[model samples]
Each structure stands twice: as structure tokens, then as C-alpha cells.
Target: MTTWMHPEIGDWEARGRRVAASGPTLGDVDVFVVDAPARTSEELEPLVVVHGFPTSSFDFAHLVDQLSDRRRVVLVDLPGFGLSDKPDAPYRVAGSADAVASVCDQLGLRRFALLSHDMGDTVVGELLARQLDGDWDVDVTRRVVTNGSIYIEMAHLTDGQLMLLSMPDERAARGPGPELLAASLVATLAPAHADVDMSAHAELQCHLGGDRLLPRIIRYIEERRADEARFTGAIEAHPSDLHVVWGPEDPIAVAAMADRLVAARPDATLTWIEGAGHYPQLEEPRSYLEALRAAIG
Candidate 1:
């Protein structure tokens, strides 16, 4: 029902459907969801992926098959991002967490391993909190956390990010076009990964007037700053096994965050993707996949 900026990505879009879900402090709305089934008959805990800021499920278009080879892989475009409804309402991490729960409920997913990138990490943290408090009814078997500002204080916020943060916490009159969004993403990758195609990611981000909602959705960063213990604390305290696969070259989240996670959870495993930055899955797909397989294996 929507016109994609680049029709070539239609196959990826075809794999997903819009589900009725609620957002932070809002009523039921359409949330874009993708559920790639397991290829093998061997039963394995499904993997539910939460994506980062300014991007959508399309981020994993290339890896969904490999990831689902052994178990199901579910991805959702949190409201206000991707092809989801971008209503001019206040956005928060808790609501995004609820959106994930709604999608999982619709799909009959009660337990799964978790993989999160960027802002998705914070959303997972909120879900973890709910599970601990007896709010949401789901089991997070294990976790693989990539680069995100879980430790807000330790983050190196990019210029573009700072600019967006400085804007009013509401829909902007105008927002970055696809080219600008693509450039910002490219800047976060390792130098050697400068050629990664971010076109579809940027286009999907700007869909349904999503460009104007960046300021509203990015408020999750502020939420992390205001309440680190609630988010990062959940990650540290959760009983699920934790494995961290990081791109040491990430300028924003920084390598120290992963080190701190290991320090907090002594038993947690940490794998570094050499020559890769914030988006290791895109920068070094081979190394990232190997590390992911090893983490879940």
C-alpha cells in the first residue's frame, strides 16, 4: 500500500506485513514486521532482532536467511521508523518495547534469543525490565548485543546526532532527505566500509514522513541519559547468557562500552570485529556472521 523509494527492495518488503500494534503512550497502530522461519527441522529458540536508530528491519535484508537457517528471525520497524505509521506522538523506549511484544504476541512467539543493534538495545533493555517485573510474558533465552549507547555517558555522539538532539522534541517541519540520511550512516562505519549501500535504509527511514519524526524518536537517547540504570541495568542483571559482538572501530558507542559489559557480567563473552565500526554486520558481514553463529551455537 506504500510506494517505496527504491522498488528493488520490494522483495524484502514483501516478506513483511503491517501488524496492529501500540506505540509508546498511543493506541493500536500499524507496525511493520518480518518473520523469517527456521530452515531446519531441529528445534532452536527463535531470534528476535531489534534494529537501531534511523533504520528499519531492512538493515538485515542480507543476513535474515543465514540467521534463520537454524531458527526463526523476527524483525520489526518500531513505529515512527521504516514503513510503520509515523504519527506525531511522543515516542519512548518503553513503547517501542511494547511494540515488539505486540508483534511477538501476534506471531505466537513466547520465547526467543535476542539480537539488538543501536536503539534496539535500549528497547530490549526495557523489555527485560518488564520480564523481570512480571509485566511482559516472554522468555529471553540469550542475548547478542552489538554497538549501542547503553552507557550514555561513554558515548561519542556524532555531529549529526547532536544536531538532531538539539531540535525540539517534536516532529520537525522538514528533515534530512535520503542522501543526507545515507551520508550520516556512512560516516559511522569503518573507513574501509565506506562503500556499504545505505540507500534502502535511508529511503525506508524517510517513508511515511518519517524524516520529520527523527527528533521525536531520537528522544530515546535522552531517556537513556535520564535513566541508565533502568536500561543498562536490565542488560547487566538479566539471567540470560550475554554475548557481545562489537566493532572496535565504532566512534559513537566506543569499544569501552563492550568492555564495561564484560566487566559487569564477568561470564559474558565478547568478540571484536576487526576493521569494522558501528555497523559490523554491514562492514564485515563475514566476520560478523561467524561471530554471531559462534555466539548462538
Candidate 2:
């Protein structure tokens, strides 16, 4: 295992790519990239992965080996989450998409495929929109959108989320507390997935934001609703190959949201990961990776 990963994470971190270079992304925001040195195959385009809220690039840690087997993998801790800088700013989908682009540029990526989960899926939508606008700044070859509330009207968020959001913004300053933060993170995934350990995830919450940035991070939920049209519209009218691999059992995103995405973009191929949860990539790593291999191909 590489020294970059926590000791608690152990050998799982050794499963695949090692960090080539990791540091602050554009705007001096810290973002780590677990990458393999140099190119393995020129035929394979790099894969840029953007993680959702409340979780960092670590969520995809388990799938890094499979994802990078052929292509170089770039995992980012979106601003306000993970190992990235959590500035007290409104974290919007569009902004995150731009950050992803900046990360690609900083890493010297000219073209890539994208896979995003939860709110991160919306960031993929922003990139789709940018592609639709003919922005040559970042070239995205394919996109795989997974469990997310991209369609606000179509999502079924949890009461825990509502309660957390309802708590005054100051609660983050007072601290959301480990238990509260831990519970909210677990609730989004399938309750049956007891095998999915979240101890590291919970620990990440407290340390990632100095235990006082939840309120600022929670603002992404509002941004999701506000940017619905622009983001979803791009998905509906996507420019490149599109795929939607969803866990029908996800409580928050729900399978219906996947259906809507596929329907809107009839060109999108939908892969169903049965008995999985919101974090399908984590819940069913093998199936998710196979689906991604097909999607990206």
C-alpha cells in the first residue's frame, strides 16, 4: 500500500494505482490524484472521476484497480469534501464541473471519460452542458452517470437529510457531530448493505472539514434543485456516449431517476446493479467496473 492512504485503510490501498502527484488543485484547493506513473496504453483515454457529497474520492478507492486497468484514473476530492479544501462557499454542480476541468488541465489531460456518483453525477451533467456549448477547454469522450438526484422532482431524499438541512446553518459551526454525520452518510445507501463499513467515512467527516464545514457542504442540495434545468437538460441532450448504471434499490436517488435519464437521452445505455445501494461502485465494485468498461468502450 502507498503511504498516501491511511493505515486503517491498509492493504486495500495497495490494490491498484499509486499516487504520481497529489496536491492543491486549481484555485489552491487541495485535491489528491491516485495515479499510475506515465501512460500504460495510448489507446485508452484517461478517466476523470468526481465523487458526490459527504464522501471524497476515497469512495472509489475499491474500484481504482479495475478502472485503471486500461486507462489512467483521476479521482478528485471536490471542493468542500474529501481531502480537498472546504471553503465556506456555495458548492454548485457547475462550479464542481469547472474544478474537474481545472484538475484535468493541471494534470495535463486533453481528453477523458467521466464517471460520477450521487451529486457528482450532476457535475457530469455540467460537463455535458459545457460540451454542448462547444467549450474546448476540456474534452470528455464518454460519461457514465450513476445514482444521483439529477432530476430533483424525481428524487426521494431521506428524512435524515431533511432534518440535517433543517438544522440552522450554524450547526456546522457548532459541529454536526460524528454520530449525526455518520448516520446521514449511511442512510443514503441500502440498509441491507451492512457489509459496507463506514467507520473510515465517518472519521473522514470530522477530519475533512475540521468538523465544522457540514453546513457549507450541505448547501449543495439547494444547488442541485437550482441548477436542475441546465444540468438535466444537458444530460437529456448529451453530446457524447452516455451510460447510466444505477442501483434500483437506492433510496435517495431511486431507480425512477435512472429511468428518466435513460428516457431523456434515448441514446444512453442503462445498466442495472441489483441489490445495490446509492454507492453502487462501492456496494458492487465488480459489476460497476464491468459496466464502466462497457460504457467507456
Judged by TM-score, which candidate is best? 1
Off by over 4 Å in 1: 1-3
Candidate 2 per-residue C-alpha lDDT over 111-141 given as tens digits, one digit per residue, 9 for 90 to 100: 8888888878777777778777877466678
What local lDDT does model 1 show for residue 203?
A: 91
Give the per-residue lDDT digits (tens) of candidate 1, residues 1-297. Answer: 666768657888899888999644657779988888988753789999999998987877889889998898899998888878899988988888889988998899998999999999999999998899998888889999999999999999999889989999989999898999999999999998899988889999888778889999999999999988989999999999999999999999999999999999999999999999999988899899999999995
Give candidate 1's TM-score.
0.97
Using lDDT as the measure, the top candidate is: 1
Residue 99 error for model 1, in Å? Answer: 0.1
Model 2 pairs whose backbones collide: none
- Model 1 CA lDDT for position 116: 96
